[model samples]
Target: MKTHLTILLTLSSILTFSQNIKIPSDTMVVTTHTTTVKGANINYTASTGTQPVWDKKGIPIASLFYTYYERNNVKNRAERPLIISFNGGPGSASVWMHIAYTGPKVLNIDKEGYPVQPYGVKNNPNSILDIADIVYVNPVNTGYSRMIPNKEGELPKRETFFGINADIKYLAAWINTFVTRKSRWESPKYIIGESYGGTRVMGLANELQNNQWMYLNGVILVSPADYKLYNTSQPVYSALNLPYFTAAAWYQNALPKVLQEKDLLDILPESEQYAINTLMPALAKGGFISAEEKETVANKMAFYSGLSKKVILQNNLDVPTSFFWKELLRDKSGYTIGRLDSRYLGIDKREAGSSPDFNAELTSWMHSFTPAINFYIRTHLNFKTDIKYNMFGDVHPWDNRNNNTRDDLRQAMAQNPYLKVLVQSGYFDGATTYFGAKYTMWQIDPSGKMRERFSFKGYRSGHMMYLRQDDLVAANDDLRAFIKNSLSNGKPAKYEKD
Candidate 1:
């Protein structure tokens, strides 16, 4: 009996010693920094850390990496507004926005956004830190964020944070954890998302408020994509793209001499009016329309889009953006214009192809940003980690199954009447056209009751408009005004300028 008892006690002690115990997460590295913008000396705290994600049963699921910046000396941190921002690739890290426009430091790239050699970064004079503290979050499978090892000692599958609904849940949890951990629960919150991130913030606003019990003061969407409105399967999507086509044509001087001479802003509405009233119905009618009607529609599309009537008719009066992109520049040099930024042009090995070899606009800045981020994170911020940073990592099998966020945003507004939204886009951005964004906003709040809380501003650049020096300043200025207006107690005014 004594020998059996001894064996049992020895086995129990061995099992306890072999089990992996959870030590408290390593202390995060915090760097204090200062930068003067607009003649204000801003003392700020820059901290790069990971926030653990927990499941329903409180099991740790993942670690979300984030770079947080908060301005010091604020009399009331709770009264100040905080902006939580992220970039979207479903796989992209938040570095694009952080290094491009919002963070204290920005990449010193050229006017066209191509890198100047020696790949240098400098303090961003236009940083939004003057108005609000910023947090740049990298979702799972992107940047330094990753899944925690499970009992099997394997990482969780990407499904945990890659889907539309799952993404919102994890991100909402991260935001809640971040605010609570930092003790900024009382602060006025805002969210800024670019590209798919823009799509993300819409859903996140609702999720955070309804599920997490957190309310926001405002939401800023930069080049936002609307899955509902941008559907290529619908005839309306083709029609909605006309204004952008005209804008791109205008930029390339491919439009009619009369149209080219007119101010772009003045002539764009003509294109919008034509697409809405004429092209939309004709396309919807399809085969039922008379031959004469089809001919007229084709001619009008050609006139506005700078495409030949023959090609427009060949496509059945509906030219997909891919065909237009390739066809527009084929005659000129067999070069294709970029979809992200129509301003940039590239050559394709297959000149007759419908799409370009690659997106010139996207490739232009990758060289500069990738290296700059890697260097800055390690040398400047002192956030050391062996994990490879994913500037545009593969989050493949990317669950794009559900992309609708109109209802989510609308529900958020309905729940919190004080919530304001500002959508800023560039005229030259083909990825998420300004017209498409406007249509989506209108669809979201057609009654116009929320009109007072919404604002749409357009710039003369591409998807990442801040790459242009002038647009960067203008966007920052507009954002500054928007943030102040949102926090004001006065009734919000309608910002739709006809």
Candidate 2:
């Protein structure tokens, strides 16, 4: 398997076209201010501490640590825009975005996440700090950030790191201190989130507005998950059927002769329309129709999706993504394909039955860069610390599991009535279906008359669309334009139809 997963400049902050993790000693001169906030103890004061990377023995080491950075209206020849960024995993670090994508200086990448040696880091001219001063945070466990250990530096997995409410509360308090120190009460603040980070950002947006009586200027949700809990849980069998068939057809150039005649862009509308209007309705009516009728419908759907009618009938019109992997690439070697995107072929012909092709693009790379970056912060960024980086912390399950769409969305909208949401997705991103976002946008009040406030574009890649240079460049352009217009007029163009 020739893994194309070389250096992917996974979208966002503090990195670059760079190489090497061990960083040289440098002083950050990280500044701070002080204030009080309501916390578990109510004695939470805004203070800056040189977070040290502590050893298992609870000894402070000059490895990787975190402190605090604040400067409200950072007088950038004028008042600066305030922006806070974070990475998602329910337990990931914010360094990925803060250090790699938005900070003043960044690690390097060449359009892709490939390293530009001589320390794989550089001054990111593209850093949005020019317009929005950025604050990057590390959640409880993921980075060098850690908590008191129970036994032998080993933390409590259950009590501390296993749920969601605790996560948000701490994050809210952390932000309070962060903002108090910087005195950014006057600047227009914004939040940028990626992947699961989108969930965190939106959730945090609600918290910030509700608790602090503060509102953000805008929000940027990258590859958001509106309802993945239920969406991804769709009858896995049918869930697998559509996208797999679509990806297979795209890969084979076997789309309907008519769709193939036009460009892929032109064909997407019908494809998306079918998924929403036709396939969705059919699936919702599963078991309602007679077996014979179901078979007929499945076959017609198969032809429309470019799969063989026999294959459709075989799976009873609900061939899962896994089976599509085998069926589509069966002639080649019968290897199942990757889940993140079926374009990746596997070794086995049928279901893994036992194992699978590298579960996803993010798994390995996320594992790769995470520790390296932690080490980088300790040595290079030089804040000081002893906090564990909870790359994917246990969610405040209660808070998010029963998340309120109207309350959450309303709070966010009402807080930043002028909030502009810029969302982008890849058409092939079955992970966070592009249509789901479109649908969500349709549901939000601001989204209805705020079309100009929100903008979405689809590319031909998977969830991490930035892996492709063209898609990356196009997205960057759209973002730059969006940022520029947003600063000029805080209110987005009122929602309108495309």
lDDT digits (tens) for residues 316-435 of candidate 1: 887888887888878876778889889988878889877777888888878788888988887667776556788876677767677657889988997787799999999988888888
lDDT of 2 by residue, 267-309 (tens): 6666666666666666666667567766766765765566677
Candidate 1 accuracy as TM-score: 0.91
User: What are the runs in model 1 whose C-alpha is more than 4 Å off?
Assistant: 1-27, 401-404, 488-498
In model 2, the Cα lDDT at residue 201 comes to 69
Candidate 1 colliding pairs: none
Worst 10 residues of 1 by lDDT: 1-10
Worst 10 residues of 2 by lDDT: 37-46
CA shift at 380, candidate 1, in angstroms? 1.8
* Candidate 2 structure lDDT: 0.53
Query: What is the Å distance of residue 349 in model 2 from its true position?
Result: 9.2
